[model samples]
Target: MSKQLDESEIQRLAAYDIAHVVHPQFHRADHDGAVIYESGSGAVLRDVRGNEYIDGLSSLWNVAVGHGRRELADAAAEQMAQLAFSNGYTGYANLPSIRLTERLLGIVYPNMSGVFYANSGSEANDFAIKAARYFWYTSGQPAKTKIISRGEAYHGSTMAATAITGMAPFHKGFGPEPPDFIQVPTCYPYRCQWCAAKPGCTLECADAIERAIVEAGADTVAAVIAEPVHGAGGVIPPDPGYWPRLRQICDRHDVLLIADEVITGFGRTGRWFALEHWDVQPDILTIAKAVTSAYVPLSAFIASERVHRAILEAPADAKFMIGCTNSAHPTACAVALRNLQILEDEGLVERARVMGDRLNAGLARLRESPHVGDVRGLGLMAAVEVVQDVATRAPFPPSAGIGPKLARAMRDRGVVTRVKGESILFAPPLVVTEEQADRMVDVTGDAIDAVTKGQA
Candidate 1:
């Protein structure tokens, strides 16, 4: 914790890490050794041992502009000197946060008037949930306290955010959950719960909400939250008509639609926001991660004018219901503003579109491989679903640890991929070149082939 250690020294320290570091979501029964990263640049990272690897997962779905961008570094440094820390609470304003809010709202469509800042995606989504409740309370609809979210969704780790998350395992042992949070089916066409295919299926998946509302009682539900493209929960992009139907359903039931744009925002989906691809906007949108390309910890919970007006018209005592110490940190906001400027001027969104198409096609060619079951994605976010047998869609036995094995094999070959459930996720920095995109596909193809063959 004193002077920075050399590689060998770091590895020794890493040895201690293995003995002590309890990484989240890891299978502690067999995981050994610390994975050490040294440094990085435009689309790649190197280990302490000097093994360079493509940053295929963009350091957990952030890193939009990629590593070692001096411009971002310089921006961070300058802001630090001028105003290291300032809270934008109680009508206080800082230049960076004020400017960042204006810039963010500009990219958003149909005009969002207010931006609520937080330190991370989890916190941002947490704020959105609280704000929804606060807005309804302010409007004299105190009974509208419940929130409905989709199964197989990822919001964040905060209690309120996690409460709305529909994934069951994330809630195991930690609950005693809050009242009024409910779950409904996800529009995952690949794993549709209602088996909604040609069999009155298109709207069936989305219509489950109608059932949920009927059961939960429409008056009790305040909002329904979803990721236009579910990121951590298997990168699920809803079916063709799924989102549009949800928009109509929410309108009919008087439930506010909250889009969790934490992962799909800022060109990751080839659009400014993934919902835009579906031409669906939400009453509230929560964003983080790529907002500043992960150069700083910052997030925004945006409100459409309807939601904005509801909050604005509230009596004076609502007290800015939710904000943290770092909510709109001046330095973080300054970096975010500059980051968007770069994304705009460089046309990175267009680049993500062209390169994503090329990579998805390249991956589709490998579907013949036994282990490749599904390749699905939009823009920079992609996933390869591995199965034991594609014909039956049989998963490897739970005892086999198939996902971690394949990921480690890919790592040995100098590419780092993220294994989520049965899928290997690929989300490189948006600045990745076409050749690098091909390399990402090629390396994973090789890894998949080897892992399946080895298991056989």
Candidate 2:
């Protein structure tokens, strides 16, 4: 273990961070209040001040196998010693990249035949967009350039990924919205305007995709991109029938289905991939995060055979020309390969299913609380929706500051998670034990009670 820093040294580091580092989702007002994490092991993290908290969000929906594994560190070091970087352009290749791709193809949808590497989820999704457009362009349907996304979807921060993202906050101050990106309703059963009142899912949200495609003129729509289980968007899993119908809709309209599995891939969900739960295969799939359990920066977009053939057949002048400098960094790929091995050997995926049941069951007890409007999740990923009035499902206004207050309460109670709007998101590592899972639930329930007590 590294030497533990004194309080003064920790404060000095925090001062340096405030001076130099610009974090993502940055809030100027809250910058100084940031928790400076120093070390982690399994589902627990310790701040610079030596306070430990249960990692309820898996350090941002990644780190499936957990943190501080010697094997992963050794993997990176071994690969770096031999070959740290390589040119992954069309003509050049690396062994780790080649082996990792082969392993991915064997595990992912059988129809997928090619993988394009990038450095992050945003870049992977951007490549997904390019691959979708390239397929249509080469197939003589150049007009089919529009991509449809769902509301509450969080793709990434890149320009194209931002345009494809459905959340307005991400788009705000991002300059002009890129053209040809269409937004449609998501399968959010909780606050769904169409079918929330119904006894069962009408799947009106899925049909909304069809409506958008029709409105855009199906011929002009290239692809419909979505997360199989919406992650950053409140951990909302679609209805069981959602993906099958979505597959049919995309097939009927000749629109490609791009599953952004950045957060749900690599055993974060019970299955290796979330769409696999529904037996639905997407035309293009983007995966990252737990591909290496966030030990290193690496991501890739896989293309189905049909899409691959289209790109392969492109004319010399109109070649599918897109590549990243660190496309398949040898060190990252090596680390990812070892990470995959760790996941399979330990059966972390099945653990997620079993532990997910335990976690959800614990959270279900909180439903009796008047403020908890809903409790929902799949596998180890879940959310608790807080509301002002359970009868009307009315949300607390922004001025109430319920999310921030609940977040602070949970942190104080030795749990750390994401509190978005009125929803508290939880995605602990797949390796989280039953005791840790129960502690998270208990802390969440107690935090809710403490934060919302006496609130009208």
Candidate 3:
């Protein structure tokens, strides 16, 4: 076991992190002075200073079963002892990986016939994009290679996945996005820019996709990729009719649908997969994060039989050969299997639904506050959109830095969360209790009031 570090030691470690660690998706200047987290268990995390905070974002929307699970650690140790380093690249298979694939299929939708392994959500999405392009190539429709994602969508960090990501910040300094990846409007109802977005108004957000499909021409489009709930893009759940309409549009246009379930998969949204809430099935599905509860890196790119048949059943000479060295790592698969078992045995999915209601209700009460514009989410995944005026729905100028202010206040109050622009995101571990959920909501409300007291 590791001993607690003294103040001097913690300062030294923070300095080292500043000098050596290149934190992803963070402002370099901020990370240079960021807090150094030491360890965590259950829904709480401790910084190097030994201050505990409720893990509101589940440490990047993973850790579904919570932190420091001994069963998962034991599973990893046992698998490592038995066979830690088999190369799936050379057609060598390991027991844990084999079992993980079987287990995933048994729990996932029936159409997901095969699983391709990777190391992260980004890798899974990258592979899914490649698989879609390869599927079209093998089907003798090479021109059908364009992928349609929504504006403000986030896929992953890799070049191919980055190309699919619709968030402008991720692509700002990156060179031109890869060819044939197009972005359409998102089905975000909270801040919908298209129309009034009230009852009886047309779902122009969904219609925008069909328009993009027509503009690209059906034959030129390969797939429509989306997250069930746009997590990184402000936790915006889709309009009720959005996903089913997208599914119908994809089918009508012969475009494959790819659900990027990295954030919403594995009971985050009160369902095994967020798409299940709408009963909408995608041709390709990518999963990560909660797969191993973030204990071990593991991701899966699952394909329907149609996609599988198109690629795997191709002639040997025409097969698309692609894989990573860490694909199907036995130890990671073992940890993930154990994590899934815990999620099932503990009934965390149903728990997420029940407790999530409490979380959302508590958050909804905050809309009575002056700065709160909206409270929205499904299950444990949710957000509170902060604005200058709830009546006018006017967002505070980025110059106000309300997001950063609220984040700091919430941290001071012993709660950790993610602030995306004007939206404060909440995705606590599925295992979080109702009391913890209430605490998280209370902290969020206090943060909002403390930050927006004068302005609001």
On TM-score, the leading prediction is 2
Candidate 1 residue spans exceeding 4 A from truth: 1-8, 19-22, 26-31, 196-201
Q: All candidates' TM-scores?
A: 0.95, 0.98, 0.97
Q: What is candidate 2's lDDT per residue for 188-259, written digit by digit as tens?
A: 999999989989899989999999999999999999999999999889999999999999999999999999
Q: Give lDDT per model, in order.
A: 0.83, 0.92, 0.88
Clashing pairs in 1: none
Model 3 over residues 267-338: C-alpha lDDT tens digits?
888888888888888999999999999998999899999999986688878866888999999999999999
Tell me the spans in candidate 2 whose CA falls farther than 4 Å from its real position: 1-4, 454-456
Which 10 successive residues of model 1 have the least lDDT summed? 193-202
What is the lDDT ranking, best to worst?
2, 3, 1
Q: Which residue pairs show backbone clashes in model 2?
A: none
Question: What tens-digit string does per-residue lDDT give for candidate 1 at 376-446?
Answer: 88988888999988777778996887888878887887788778777888888889888888888888888
Instruction: Estimate the TM-score for candidate 2.
Output: 0.98
**Largest lDDT belongs to which candidate?**
2
